[model samples]
Target: PGPLSPSPPQLRAQPQGAMQVGVQARELRQPMAMAMAAAAPGQMVMSAGMQQLAMLPCIDVQERAQWLQEATALLGAEIEMANKYRVLDQVGNQFFYAVEKTDCCRRQCQNGLCADCTSWEVDVLYTPPGGLMQKFLALRRPCSCVCCCINRPTADVIDEATGQKIGSFRDPCTCCSLRFQVRDASDTDVLVVNGGCCCTQPGILCPLPCGPCAQVRFDVEDAESRSTVARITKRVPSCLSWFFAPDVDSYHVTFEHIQNPQWKAIMLAFTIFMDFRYFNVNRNQEQARDVLAEL
Candidate 1:
């Protein structure tokens, strides 16, 4: 579609309860992990496991937030780039149209020279969708100038050689794609669901220190002027175990998606580092057990 003027798009109905429900479930899991840790303090092994799982939710939250922020910033940058191009249809362009006081007096006044009026009223042509026109409307109050408050006039596209109006321009329609899938450890148990309102690209894997096992799908409404929504889910069982565990150990860690763009990459990298740390911790534990056995 040609660039839509900056006038607010029509709002659509939103999937009201879904996002909140997912958030609440995520939040609830944290306290549940804490309770488990308290109950299994003597079982240091179990407590540690639970704590590790608890950390996953926290990490997921942080990561998600970070990605959301980054994505929003990127959206802003895209808009700015469009503005820099100054590409607009006739109805989407706005400009200042000023006439000197003398010209106004000579054209409209009974006397050729209107001595009382120092300046002529200036009319500003404002278009919709484009940022420049929006800004003009915001800054300039309503006035009597003919151009200042006029609706966009239609223009016919005429072929210079043929001297005929061409009817080739067509408005573009909005379209989107969304997909969801779950894969098991062997990567063989792949279940795919396709066709939704959002994009279908796979999310980055932020593996927990433990490992990956199951993936879940999540859907949420897009934050556009239009109330478009989308769904996506990735589950790693190893990560889920850590997310659900109750006790924290030196090796415990969590993976969260905090809606930040860079967060997914950062969290994924952090999780890989934590996995190495977990391996070292396990090696140390094994060595200590051997010594105890010998003693």
Candidate 2:
């Protein structure tokens, strides 16, 4: 059994070192907490956002493999789902997480002709899977009229913390193929995203790699010389069992040379925009078209 509690008289006779030992314990705890706070992000598989955004510059196919961040992304913002994505690097380290944001009212309004025609504004928040979960980017895609794909569509990339536009991606309204002019904060065109289609009617998904044998992709070109600098290619999802799981998508984004992180983020947003505008309508009609067996 432990000794009984010391009386007041016994406590008065205690050594000064005993009192100091008690004080030292509490003081030691403060620094330990600070160290833990500083080390929390280091525990992730590899750093997110920073590492992926510093895209590996490659002039040939050999260097492309290392830079491939094959994202598992979702689609159908214009259809039923709002969409979500878990962007992963080649080695499966999560680069970032993205989820679509549309007002409940706006989502509910997505019905009838308005369903396919309404280019309702959709926002996507980009954040890491763990740690502080602070938003890295906020993407706002404005609505576009899709009647025969003649309209110009645009998306704005804003700094999550500051709410200021870092850059923008806009279609220059090409008639034969799909095209976009990626501009920086100063509105100077930095990159061009170009795509060719099998059908003459382009835009929508036409600007994306849409040939039967061709890889579904968009070539990121230099605005000045129209040189191919990067490419965003859509990859099929691994799980294909769902009849209409209202599937999401994934893409491999690569750069021949990229100097800015903001541009990388902006280009990523364009992939999601392409999915919603082009790949979404067909799946949306399934609810109305499916043959019903009386259950």
The estimated TM-scores of all candidates read 0.16, 0.61
Which candidate achieves the best lDDT against the true structure? 2
Q: Per-residue lDDT tens digits of candidate 2, residues 154-229?
A: 6777656445676677766556576778776556666677766546333233222233422456787766655566
lDDT (C-alpha) at residue 44 in model 2? 20
lDDT of 1 by residue, 243-287 (tens): 322111221112222232112112222222222111111112233
State the number of backbone clashes in model 2.
Answer: 3
Give Cα distance to truth, residue 176, candidate 2, Å: 4.7
Worst 10 residues of 1 by lDDT: 78-87
Candidate 2 whole-model C-alpha lDDT, 0 to 1: 0.48
Clashing pairs in 2: 73-249, 74-248, 209-217
